[model samples]
Target chain A: MNQTIIQEVRETTPLIHHLTNQVVMNFSANGLLSFGAAPVMAKAEEETAEMAANANGLLLNIGTLTSQELPAMINAGKTANERGIPVVLDPVGVAATPFRTNAVKRILSDVQPTIIKGNAGELAHLVEIPWETKGVESVGDGNADEIALKVAETYQSAAIVTGKTDVICIGSEVVHNHTGHPILGKITGAGCLLGSILTACLTTNKSIEQQALTAVQFYGLAAEYAAERPDVNGPGTFLSHFIDALAYDPAKLERE
Target chain B: MNQTIIQEVRETTPLIHHLTNQVVMNFSANGLLSFGAAPVMAKAEEETAEMAANANGLLLNIGTLTSQELPAMINAGKTANERGIPVVLDPVGVAATPFRTNAVKRILSDVQPTIIKGNAGELAHLVEIPWETKGVESVGDGNADEIALKVAETYQSAAIVTGKTDVICIGSEVVHNHTGHPILGKITGAGCLLGSILTACLTTNKSIEQQALTAVQFYGLAAEYAAERPDVNGPGTFLSHFIDALAYDPAKLERE
Candidate 1:
């Protein structure tokens, strides 16, 4: 475990500016708060640019993209890039519709994201790789490693591919995270919550890859703890415990 | 408790179309699902009318509303009205800003909501009643009864004023619910989740007030059940247990 990154995030409580999908705003905000970071969800075009400029990290997600938010997302991303702050982009359900794909493309063309995160199918679409996809669920039985590598090389940014075994790639280097529970799949916005916390993690002076790795491992560990609770009988129970685990003291997260 | 409404919602599994705010979409969807209602969140202007027209109920929430969605919300509400399905309006945080207030007013003018739900502050603003408010929290010490009654009279729709105690007013009759937990106040979308379930409950053959009472009673009971769980410690745990309790068989929920 990269305790330094976790410690840094907790101590600093970085402010994360989110122009994320509407579906996960509350969860993302709560998750970030639980993880000891400040979250500000502002997508209005009138204030996004200014908000992004001041935030320690910026996250842009397209889970519920509309034509109207593209300009605001781009403006925020551009401002984050200019400030040299980390910008994490989660191109959720990019392959589900042309409007989503086109919107992601527009954001990509204008902003140099520091880290790009998505499931394998969504990442495959980003790098133009052939991977079976159905409404952002499956990464399928393709070369997930190749897809992650391609996404890393194509986007010129670190890529995190979340699935049964999460894969993260930055340039030629790659890391795999296997500490997770399947309950995360049953709940919505597990990945979105991860993206939000990742934004905060990357704000530390640590390497983006190191920060991403620590964040992923810590998140999965939290899920594991949450799911293992005796009262956590289903997705609903696990969801609540997961939030509590995020706020749990990392030093006390030892497994039995 | 009206067990019939719960049975009807579980049996029919009504399809609820939600044009709600981004902050609570996931929670509302999951909560509604847990309550035996299917939630479909669609806000695109192009498809909202079609979606709402086909749904058993429609929910319009303006928590984090944007300028682009007012037309879509109005269109969906109008469609629901044309089909004679219930439209549940949650004017969340309307007093915070003019954009939110104006958007709710616009939807109110174009669409006849069958049940208008809000905190006393929001509902008071709707009825042109004065109440102290900051953002979306307080109902203060105002005449919440008058606020609910005036809103019911003014909109010609049932009004629900939610605060420490929830007041439901339909025409001249008003009912107060006393079955919730203080922990509900700590969560972000407790009210929004109630509105979604209320939409589903209103779809039954029973009178609107009966269904509303049942929904409110069942929701508050679920919160109480969840909050009393031995393992539940805070809002995070309460949230998850609340969802589980929403799905719990009513027969099994009786306290010791």
Candidate 2:
């Protein structure tokens, strides 16, 4: 992945419309802002489509699925589709409840997102693969790269299955990112924030595979930087330092 | 305010059900947890009442009001009232739009919250006092103590008006807390997080005025401690440090 994607995101400051869950909206917005992208959250059915039409990209997350928000998500997704703006879907906790699984199916059938992002359990649920999920957290392990590739192939969208090893798949190409820390999982919204980063990166003209790879790599690098800080004794302090790391120059971090 | 209120909150670990905006859910939940309160967010109209009934307290915030969430908020509020669990209301962005203002009125008339929490601009809007509000942030100056007193008397509830000086009022009695930092305003949900903290505090057997006062003072002190950290250079760092400070013992901080 080209490091220039990060620079491009900073320069463009793409306006991203987020129809996300209540659990991670503030952190996702703040994370996007730290990465120099503008974030606008509009969940009202009355305004979501218009907001999506005006935005450079759209992110749809279903962590806190509500019956009322389903239509707004579909509407915003369709609008982003119409505008040809990239849409990233974070199927959060899809295995947690039947409501979430149905909602993800509804969105997949209607919106046709440009990228589908989820953890291994969520991705398995998306593809009907057996995996143990304790609420939103994936407890059982699986081949992330294979799952990402299968989901991308089945849905015809770029897929990112995140875990200890982050897997990004677009068509036949697959990549892995292993720069994140365990503390990243201790805080909420780490994966949700990654979806926002992907939305910003997708706004650029990079290939879908490159866009997915760049977002995953950049986010993991930021988490690593934050975890290494002396003041970041735990997840609480790491949350703030992670934001600071996002705003820091990516060039300063050690490269693979 | 008795400093022992903090010790009580830590002992109770009250479960708080939040029907809040998407903008501040994660931060509020994390803040509550750091203060030794268990936080649960349920916005679906189907489950809100059940969740509220099970919780020790409930919080209703209107920062990102949607037509769908209105019914859920009302249901949860009524259930919490019926259960005799304290419900805290944060009339966020009440002056920014009529939709929000009318929603606040509806909740106020229906919920009968035990505590009404907001900034000066929001509190003023509740009682029809003219004040300038730039979105959710208060821009106009007003007597927070006077506004808080009026709101509390009119609604028959404790009122907390937070600003450079935090005001807590129950009936005719009003108190001021001078502990928070300016950077609290720089973050998205500083006021909203305080509402959650108040919810946890109200779960104790303390008087309404003392509950409000203790919550305001404790939150402000945490913000001040967070701001004093050497690694905390700006709002991003302050956010993480604030959470850390919330988890820190107040006796450890330098006494004024």
Candidate 3:
């Protein structure tokens, strides 16, 4: 992926509207701001559609979904679709409960996200592939690339499955990113922040496949940079350094 | 304030159940964990009461209030009250919208929080004191100590108003803490995370006023420590070091 995309994000400062989970909003917003993207979180059903219409991109995450947020998510997704702004969906813990699975199914059918991002287990669940999930963490072992490809084909959107090896698929073309660290999983909102980053990346005039791959690669590399810092002894410290890494020079990051 | 309270919090590892806003949940949980407290976030009405019953303390923050979460907050607060577990209320953005103001009033009447935490604007709004607020931020300048004292007297509970100087009041006694930094206002959830920490501190066997004051001082000292770090050039890096400082030794913090 061209590193210029990061520069583009910084220059543009795209406004991305998020109708995401309660657990990850602050991290997601801070991460977006660090990546040089403006994030606006509006969940009130009365204002979500307008927020989405005004944004350059929209992200829908169901990590800690409530009955009230479900409609707002749907409304924002539909408005983003109508406005021609890219919508990225993170199907967090879809296999954890019937309520979540049904919600994702409804979102997929009604909103039609431009890019669908999740872990192997979440992506597999979306495609009706049997997978074991414990709460929001993906535990099942499966061919992540195949699952991502299948989901992309089914939804007719770009698919990104992140893990030790991040997989991105648009139609039949696939790319793998091996830049992130194991510590990424230790902190909550790491995946959710990635979804926000991808939403920001989607605002740029790039192909869906390239945009998703770039986002995964950028986030993974930042995690690697943060994990190597002397100050980052644990997940708590890693969070601070990771945000700093997001705002680091893309050219310098690419050189490293 | 007795510094031993910090050691008690570390030894107890109190489980704090949070019914907080969507924006600050992840940070609040991480902050609580960094301070040697177990954090549990449960919002579903069906399970919140049981969760509250099992927790050592409960925190209710109405930062991103939705119609669905209002009832759950009430239920959890009532359950905590019934179980005699301390409930701390962060009346976030109550002055910004009537929806939030009404929800806070309902919770105040029904749940009866053990300690009420907010900025001067939020506390003032609780008593129908006119104050200008921009979104969740407190913009109006007023006597924070007076407002805190009035709120505490009216509710017959401890009241904490946090800003450049943190103020805690219970009955006729009032204590002012000049430990926090200006950089705190730049980050989202800085106040909300304080509510979580205060909740954890409440689980210790200390007076309500002392518990609130110690939490504020400890957090402010952590922020000071984080700001002094070599890598902490801005809010992004400051956040990382702050988490590490939360887990730092109380003796070391005192020496500095």
In terms of lDDT, the poorest run of 10 residues in model 2 chain B is B247-256
Q: What is candidate 2's CA lDDT for residue A213?
A: 84
DockQ of 1: 0.19
Extract clashing residue pairs from model 2: none
**Model 3 agreement with the true structure over B1-256: per-residue lDDT tens digits:** 5677878989989999999877777778888898899999988989999999999999998876777778899999899999999999998867755666677889988988888989999999988777876545677898998898889889988899888888888888888999888767646688889999899888888887678888888889898888887778557888867888899876666677
Whose TM-score is greatest here? 1
| Chain A only TM-scores, each candidate in turn | 0.97, 0.97, 0.97
Residues A1-256 of candidate 1 have per-residue lDDT tens digits of 6788878889999999998877778889999999999999888999999999989999998776667778999999999999998999998867755667778889999999988899988999998887775434553777778988988898899999998888999898989999888767657688889999899899998887789998898898899899898878667887777999998765666552
lDDT per residue as tens, model 2, B115-161: 88888999998888888989678889978878998899889988888
Model 3 reaches what TM-score against the true structure? 0.66
Task: Tell me how candidate 2 scores on lDDT.
Answer: 0.84
Lowest summed lDDT across 10 adjacent residues in model 1 chain A is found at A132-141
Tens-place lDDT per residue, model 2, A1-256, is 5788888989989999999877887788889999999999978999999999999999998877788789999999999999899999999878765667788899999998999998999998888889986545677986788888889999999888898988888887888888788766657688889999999999987887777888888788889888887877656787877888888776765542
Best of the two (1, 3) by TM-score: 1
